[model samples]
Target: MPRRSRTLTGLLLFTSLTLTTAGIAGIAATANASPEAPAAAAGAHTAHKAAYSMPGMPGMPASTRASGDDPDGDGYIMADPPVTGVTPSMEVPPPAYFHEFQAKCAPTHTAPDDPIVYPGQPGKSHDHTFMGNTTTNANTTTASLETGDTTCLAPGDKSGYWMPSLFDGDTKILPEGVQTIYYKSGVTDYRSVRPFPKGLRYVVGSPMQTQEEFKNLKGTVEGWECGDSFKNYNFPATCPDRQDVQLNLRLQAPSCWDGIHLDTPDHKSHMAYPVAGGANYNSCPADHPVALPMIEFKMAWPVNGDMSNVRLASGTGYSFHYDFMNGWDAATLDAMATHCIKGGLQCDPHGYDENHPGQGAVLDENYELP
Candidate 1:
């Protein structure tokens, strides 16, 4: 994986623009898989991620964070946010949660008749070793535990293989209604998504009308190229690539949605149709469960050498999530208005679900969204 060389100035400016335009927070998430050669955990580890800090909220101090760490043994501190008296709507039980799910989620289906092939083994070569790009022996209980069952699956964990650990064995997976925006590693899909900042277009679902209602929003958008072609392994086409291009931006919306609630549609069932005579348009679900007015975008790609900026390359994606306060675009805004009104939901900053929490008359601080 390569380090990006974007300056704080561009990130800061984009952050401001995103916040104002979307009435939401801006955020970024990064993922890095271990190197290709197998080595003991004690071996020299080169894989690493850079640190990032969010802008301060009013009445908040810069040096505030909770004590404790992630029980998953990822080596990163999973501290509580600074905002006191606040808790996420999602109720993820602590360490006990993992141990419990491990037993329950254990797959009932028998392993495939073929022997598991470990990737990156010294003299012994395998399809996953080179093409999948990781040194983790894909054939052991430890690997399963580390990867969370077969969900530890290399690129396309989202769909293929039916790994049970990802859901932590909980029968309740994110509702099928949840939709996810995807950039399939290969394929000329670039034409389907446009760069941001050309100007935000109102999504068809917003509850608020009138230019006046949306007066305060603004954002910036960019796109990254994932080399030139698509190839297949055992994974799904939508899996993030190790060397995919990245797009980063910040956005903000007006007061009407500020502190307002929005709904998140069940994106899984939505139909994908290529846009008019152009590219295939994937129609997102028209309605969502929660209406949210703001969101942030962050993306990353794998680079062979040290990288300070975007470069044409071939690889997979890490992770993409949001920071509820900094950025958002028109599509999110329209959904916010429409869903908030229809679902009667509110914005919950501490929400763990994919959408913002805290709004709606039935506001349950402990509720979790997918």
Candidate 2:
């Protein structure tokens, strides 16, 4: 994939008094519009933002910073700055918990058998490991997702999450254990957290940039580690003599939304991340007021040495990106967010359901790679 680029231009137009009056009249006529009016407005704004690239903006590319710029100068990028000052919301009671669920991995090839990949273009895409819904694809819609079969231990979860497949030569490597999903608040203000609206979709990270570009570019989140005991994001982790090296990758999707648009034309402008300074770590900007649960991807890939042969469908490890399509039922998602997340109760995988007990169930817990 190639990096997307666009030139920014500024123009000053002088309108005649007669034209200006006409424009004002049109605006006034549309001021008291119907509920559908906002959708049109959001679409126009999204289109404009896509045409003008804004580097270093939150939903845009990350800003250039030197301290963590591959401090060790190794080929791999490091982790991002740790999230600080995350004081759980006091309004919510103690024991704020996460809803855990396990799902089976699906192949991400474009082939017909690979349902998660876009339809009709099989060989065009590289292999990826997917989880969540079993029927996701290019033609998948919000309605279709609601009705699609799920891979999650809890049959109710239909949302899909996926990343590039780890490989050694032509063989694919699966995680040592079942891949788990942890849904919790990234900040203390749990009261403001909300469920992901149905049909919401977004992509984090870039597939076109190189390792150097990923390391130096603003907004890119990539890192590596050895074993499970990791310390800082300054350097790649080193594996002990017998253990496999791991890539500790984290990609945080934008949480704040403009509220009206399920997705923007740029697929990002409608959302924003919490700023790094002071106590505003999870604060959403005024324009993007509605706060949705932040989706953070923390993955460990067992790829030890010689990354030269390690390549993703996008590029290399540094070019990692993932796609999410919301398929969760509205009421159930809302309850989990309100009761478990906001209420600070670590509910089981069944997600606040009374019938299912324990910490939910793990799907394919016994399954292993061939």
Candidate 3:
């Protein structure tokens, strides 16, 4: 497959907002592509609820694959293999009282393919470092995600997460630390928050635009930071050698959904952030009323003490953006939102709230709840 630069470690790369559909449904790949940096290839928006299928692999006849997540009887392996029993446990934590829970994820792989943007076309998209689901690629569909193993502490969270890669000249910088993912209520009435819809996916930052554009854009929680600094627009010119200091970025996705259309032509229209609803409550807009758990990505990288020669695969730090595809088991995810966010307690990836130890979520050593 024709491809871009890919490595185990990827770009701390961030920044970009331009996204456009490259091809039509069931689009076929070719050597020639548009002049624009393939970063513009957002997932194609289609009229059908079913995502567009990719070309089949060699020797893998539709009937030859093992039975898996394909509950729809498509004769394809769509889910992860069955999981074995795991031990139930909880983590010790300090007292806290916020309706938020967090999951930890590590980078799994880097690749040029994006199932959402350039599905089925292995080498067509920009390079990205992926986490959560380990087997993500150009052919990865929402169904495929269900059956894939995850790097996240939450095993049920087979969801796919990825962002542009970072590089020091030619050397790819792997994310040395875990990405702390938080699920919190975006509105004042935490009771109204719901779990993400099955197969729901969206892009969080605009890569096509410049760093300045991303800063003013809505839904951005932070740009880049080093230690105590919270407003570094791009990669810091130089990082300190302290334990607390490291290069990292933060992003927040919209918490309100239209309750329909898993995707749009732009891949972001179906979702919206909350607005003032009066009476001490923030509410989803009239058009998009469903309140889902707001997602915040706190990603950390290994690079520090660098004077220069750093850049993301997309562009500079400003081009930073990321993507997420829901793959959590419906019941498990719902229980988390209900028990934690709705319960108004701070929980971990395992749904274990320190203050509410009695309500600990049953999970395994890997931190995933069955």
TM-score of each: 0.20, 0.60, 0.72
Tell me the whole-model lDDT of each prediction, alpha carbons only.
Answer: 0.20, 0.46, 0.63
Q: Give the per-residue lDDT of model 2 (tens digit) for 74-139.
A: 111211221223332323324434432222333222211122223222332444566667666544
**lDDT, candidate 1, at 352:** 18
> What does the lDDT come to for candidate 3?
0.63
Off by over 4 Å in 2: 1-124, 209-222, 228-238, 241-246, 276-281, 305-308, 351-370
Worst 10 residues of 2 by lDDT: 8-17
Per-residue lDDT of candidate 1, residues 281-362 (tens digit)? 2211112111122222222222222222321111121111121111122343233333332232332221112243333322
Q: Which stretches of candidate 3 lie over 4 Å from their true place?
A: 1-97, 362-370
- Decreasing lDDT order of the candidates: 3, 2, 1
Q: Which wins on TM-score, candidate 2 or candidate 3?
A: 3
- What lDDT would candidate 2 get against the real structure? 0.46
lDDT for model 1, please.
Answer: 0.20
